[model samples]
Target: MTRSAIELPVTADDRRIARLAALAIGLTLAEAAIPSPIPGVKPGLANIVILLVLLQYGWRAAAWVSVLRLLAGGLLLGSLFAPGFWLAAAGALVSLSVLGLARHLPDRYFGPVSLSVLAAFGHIGGQLALAGIWLLPAAALLKLLPVFAAAALIFGAVNGVIVARLLAGPVSSGRQSGSCTPPSIP
Candidate 1:
């Protein structure tokens, strides 16, 4: 008996997301190189890509970029299923959820900087909550809150500024944003 092979078609949009994910993963690896006195206080350098995708493409593309980055980055760093991996996963979930909701906010009042700040808090909060539940006691987590919060706010704003600047620049001038619907998967 012979078995049939299944084929999946690749799209340009898929390629775009893959390239963005690879960039984000590269940033994650770069971030890992920085020394941090605190366990999870390193700047979220990778988030700049995600925020840019969210703005230039949409939340769905941004989410895809983030998911790919997490899986690939975890594998590359040899930290899959580790405590740090779980913490990052938890943080991504919360941050993505916040972005999903925040995307609905008005353009007049909200933009990348504010959204980034919000998602950063969500990211840190998720990590802290997970640490409190799986790694440390609530009280100890509380002791660590201020440091993490400060990191989240500062990093979030900085990443936001970077993304905002990149958006303002001619990074991808050929593409239309927000006003158009992203190409649907066939």
Candidate 2:
């Protein structure tokens, strides 16, 4: 069987989303390559891209970037439909939800750093909840909360700072005038 299509031209926004998603997936794959000393602790580098999307475009673009990363990255990492994927999906869902609400906050009070931290905590919360209810279903699993929380705080802050720097740098601009092109995939 062959597929047929009335080919539609991709818009600038479409190209931007695709590029951002590709960058996010690339970051996810890169992160996967680094061996972690702690089982559930990584820098969450992909989130920096998502956060940038949210800041530049909106929650919708960020959501697209996030869901695409979760699905595509999982497939690339050979973790699709696996326990890790579910956990990551759950975390992304909660983080996006939190970001949707938090975006309403004034920029002065809530910038990338604060937003990143909030989303990070939300991500961890969702993962822990899913693990407790579905995977382990034991109170013992809750014991890991503190460790995860600490990791979230540290990584979230770092990711937020990175995003902020990216935003301030020329990369946030639409053009590649300087050494760093804007983080928008296109």
Candidate 3:
């Protein structure tokens, strides 16, 4: 018997998310090329896309973008299910979890910069915790925490400011609430 082909319904939202995921994957690949003095201390450039999606779409869409990035990035990098992949996965999950809760916060104080910082810490904290449990010892994590925390703060703030500026720009400022399409990024 011949097997029938399966076709999934793809909406505009689906296509948009795919594009965003591709952006994230590109960032991830670029990040992998950057040299880091400390292990697991990359700038987490993909998260910029994730945070942007979270602010514009919601946690659900952000999560989809993040997961797709992780899976596709891992596959492209040839590190699927590897230790590096697990560490990144742990970080992304925690970062998304933080955004899910933090989105309920008022827009005044918890704007893109603040939320990005929170997600950054969450990502680094989650990665260190998982690494400690699965790969390294507690002492190593403690030693690495200061460096990772510093990196998280700096990178998160930068990414957040970028998103905030994007949102504040003339192109994005006119967006109506509940709009699904993102503004044309310059």
Clashes of each: 0, 1, 0
Candidate number of the best TM-score: 3
lDDT of every model, 2 decimals: 0.87, 0.89, 0.88
Q: Judge candidate 3 at residue 43 and give its lDDT.
A: 82
For 8-57, candidate 3 gives per-residue lDDT tens digits of 88998998999999999999999989998876788888999998888788
Question: For candidate 1, lDDT tens digit of each residue in 1-186?
Answer: 977698789999999999889889999999999998887798898888888888878899999999999999999999988889999999999999999999999977788899999999999999988888898999898888889898999999999888776665443567545533323322
> What would the per-residue lDDT of candidate 2 be over residues 1-186, giving only the tens digit for each residue?
977778788899988899999999999999999999878788889999999999989999999999999999999999999999999999999999999999998989999999999999989888888988898756767678788999999999999998888776663356534653445435
TM-score of each model, in listed order: 0.88, 0.88, 0.89
Q: Clashes in model 2: which pairs?
A: 171-182
Clashing pairs in 1: none
Q: Which is superior by lDDT, 1 or 2?
A: 2
Cα lDDT of model 2 overall?
0.89
Mark the regions of model 2 whose C-alpha exceeds 4 Å error after superposition. Answer: 1-5, 170-185
Q: Sort by TM-score, best first: what order? A: 3, 1, 2
